[model samples]
Target: MKTNLYSSIIEKISSDKFSSIFILVDENTEQFCLKLFIKKTGIKSFNKIIIDSGEENKNIDTCVSIWDQLNSFKADRKSLLINLGGGVLTDIGGFAASTYLRGIKFINIPTTLLGMVDAAHGGKTGIDFKLLKNQIGVFNDPLEVLLDNDYLKTLSKEEFINGYAEVVKHSLLTDKPDLTFNSLVKLDLFNDSEYIINSYSLVKNEIVKSDKYESSIRKVLNLGHTIGHAVESYSHISDEIIDLKHGQAIVIGIINELYISHKKFNFPLRDVVSVKKHLKKYFTLIPLKENDMENIYDLMVYDKKNEGSKINFVLLKEIGKPVIDQIVDKELFKESFVFYNE
Candidate 1:
């Protein structure tokens, strides 16, 4: 919950005593975030490591490269790593830092809206394994998270929309009437950044505090992620990579899961339709062929939320009211795709 920006972060880091300081960025952040970071802070005394920017790069090979760089730089147990990028950078950088020499102190400077609202705040540090999403990771908190809206100024509309999906997901999880479907559809991120970020963070942090290990209440945060991750992984491993972003996949997942909610939990059909209609305005519907469903289902079975053969879902009983650990049959899962297509 402790967030600062720009010079304040530089001052904080400058005052801290550590064996060494390292800044982890992707190719994009190196140009967009790190350069501005150095200029604004007037501090240039850190080792710089850059990786490729994409979900495909979120893997063990990236971790190995990072660990090698840290070792080459003689980063000891007391080294401090500053992750300055979007979700991929924070996730992989945190994972590398956590596992390197047991553990090291780190800070998150999330450049993307999604990173600011969700990925950077959560203590879930991870990387994908074997084309699965977040298949390998550990729970490790950062020294601090520095969120600056300035970083979002340079984002492409696609990137902005990608992050906005999490905002919508968070809004749906809250009872606040101000975050209604109409309000969400009309949201202007530049004007509403402060309210959106703080509100979503508050909800997420409270849920995480109650269940740090994702044993119960925390599962609510995974509302769109179960099917979302499956779709994401499918896009990644498909014969032709479907150019789908994480949030886009999640929006699709939310709509499909909303259908399940309508059928299984008697959630209002009208509400489900309303949510889907609003989301479609911002996200393109990715074509998922019939053959793709089985592959997506196979990926879902490997989800960390599942146990044995049953795939556990966090379905909505109503907007802002989620019922967790609900198991749906495979037949229903296939049918949900049909519902999505219709």
Candidate 2:
């Protein structure tokens, strides 16, 4: 276990305050990460709960199953649930732990780069509803989070690249004007992951501290999420489109929203072009069809961020300076989809 990545959990585990310890894992994590976790931490005695992987399983059914397992194992309020997987696992696992017995102590041991950089650290835990991304969730911080870069080595190139989108999002949100196309320009993965995860993930944590419930400033963190989520939802339902990973949809969301920002707020076109150019190297242009536009648009119309009838978006005047809760016209939102396709 990396000293810096661990928290007081190690000592707490040793102290025997919890009634029992449970490790939650998805199918993928159980196969790939479980052995390494036990070997490294020397924590051999714990109940293991395994769920199927993929965003589709992030629903009430799975939550019920998890709750059932916890009940079967006789988990108590003092019991600890440690989530050992990616975003899907952490989201549903955290949500389960929070709701079960009116919230139990849970820790996040994220095994994916995306989970490490974005999902695991933030207190936002959720499961998708009716294919809408993160439609059901609560803001509850974990007991602790463990980030080990060694896990990144287990990911395939595509899985590794899936997380790059968030890293790019964090860079654009930072004051650093020099932050350009982070991994696209060739970054040494494990060697630089600590600095990248620490710095960029902190950007989210600071914002979250200010607005944990997303009632105000936290909305800025949803920069690409508005449209990104709709895209993700569409992928879940549509036979015409292949499934999109969360970060890939978010990448599309960033591009589309940036177009709206430039059109509405006079955000620099040069910067927009720079972002598109750099992101193009990694994220391909989404194959959005003309017929699919209506479906996608309808999804955004019912998006969680919308204020009654007016759809809300986060736009930037420049990198790091975000204007939140901007009411974008429904027509304009459609235009962004067109702009993204262009």
Candidate 3:
């Protein structure tokens, strides 16, 4: 925590506004980020609520465990819960803080690259349900979001790539970036972590300011998620398929959706190919059985974004120009996946 960043967060902690404060962490964050945070902020006393790491642990069961911890520790509504990990930590921590004793104040100190750029802000706290992504969740803003690029140094390459996917998405969504999408994707995340993360945070925050509940403009944020989430869900259930990071799956969704965009909206074919070629270099390819289209299709049809039988997608007329609420049939989806595999 830098001096300027610490001023506001420390103000909240030092103030008598809360009866007590609690810090939340998963195993990875506890080992890597906890002490650094404690020493940096100089908070002498607070409760720790530790839990298992990974998306598999992000569910009602975990939420119950968190609630149990808070109850045992005597956390009150006034207590501030500081979630100090990646998306999984913030997702469940925000949910726990929101529901326990009918909502307590919470702050997010996102650790991973993905967490900083996408998961930490936006007030979307959630857990996966019924093998689907973000099926059960709430929209509750945190008291504050603290950012520090120091945490990016602790991430593994795979973890960094998980967030870089969103970086690519945000860059594509905007027409005027300081760096072009090609230059942006090719740059090393660690070398440019501060600028990249700040750019993404600004883009998401700007969009979220207009549509807090994702009614209109915010839907543009889901450009890759419609098909991406379905693939992520499919990976979760399949024994043969390795689990995909949220961003990796989203990258797949972006590539395939670009295919759909070119076919339906005539978004330049060369742009689509170039994006697919570039992103694939960063992410490991997800293996799907040749006959797995129906399985993935079923998952897509069940996507929360879909209405009735038709699946809604956010396609691009061009980079930074998203067309939302476009309904497409299953056959086109199958073709998009085919394009992705190539």
User: Best candidate, lDDT-wise?
Assistant: 3
Q: Provide the TM-score for each candidate, comma-separated.
A: 0.94, 0.94, 0.97
Q: On residues 114-197, what C-alpha lDDT tens digit does candidate 2 reach at each position? A: 998899987889898876778899989998888787877888778877887888787777775444343324565446777777
Task: Give the runs in model 1 whose Cα sits over 4 Å from its true position.
Answer: 1-8, 180-183
For residues 1-342, write the lDDT of model 1, one tens digit per residue.
223345556766677678678999888898888877887677768999989999999999999999999999999998999999999999999999999999998999899989989999879999998878898999999988877777888878789878877887787787767764446666667688877877777777777888998888888888888899999888877885575799999998888888899889998999888888877877888778788899889999988778987899999888888899998888888888997888
TM-score, predicted candidate 1 vs. hidden true structure: 0.94
Q: In candidate 1, which residue pairs get closer than 3 Å at backbone N, Cα or C atoms, i.e. clash? A: none
Q: What is the C-alpha lDDT of each candidate?
A: 0.85, 0.83, 0.87
Superposed model 2: Cα runs more than 4 Å off: 1-4, 176-191
Off-target runs (Cα >4 Å) in candidate 3 are 179-183
TM-score, predicted candidate 2 vs. hidden true structure: 0.94
Residue-wise C-alpha lDDT for candidate 3, range 1-342, written one tens digit per residue = 256877788888898999998999998888989888887788987999999999999999999999999999999878889999999899989988888898999999999888898899999998888898888888999989999978767788889889988888887788775655756876777778898888888888888999999888899889999989998888888877788889988998899888999999999999999898888788876756566778888889889888888798999998888888998777788888888887
Q: What shift in Å separates residue 186 of candidate 1 from its native position after superposition?
A: 4.7
Error of 3 at 275 (Å): 0.9
- The lDDT of model 2 is 0.83
Answer with 1 or 3, whichever has the higher lDDT.
3
Clashing residue pairs in candidate 2 (N, C-alpha, C atoms within 3 angstroms): none
> By descending lDDT, how would the candidates be arranged?
3, 1, 2
Quality of model 1 by C-alpha lDDT: 0.85
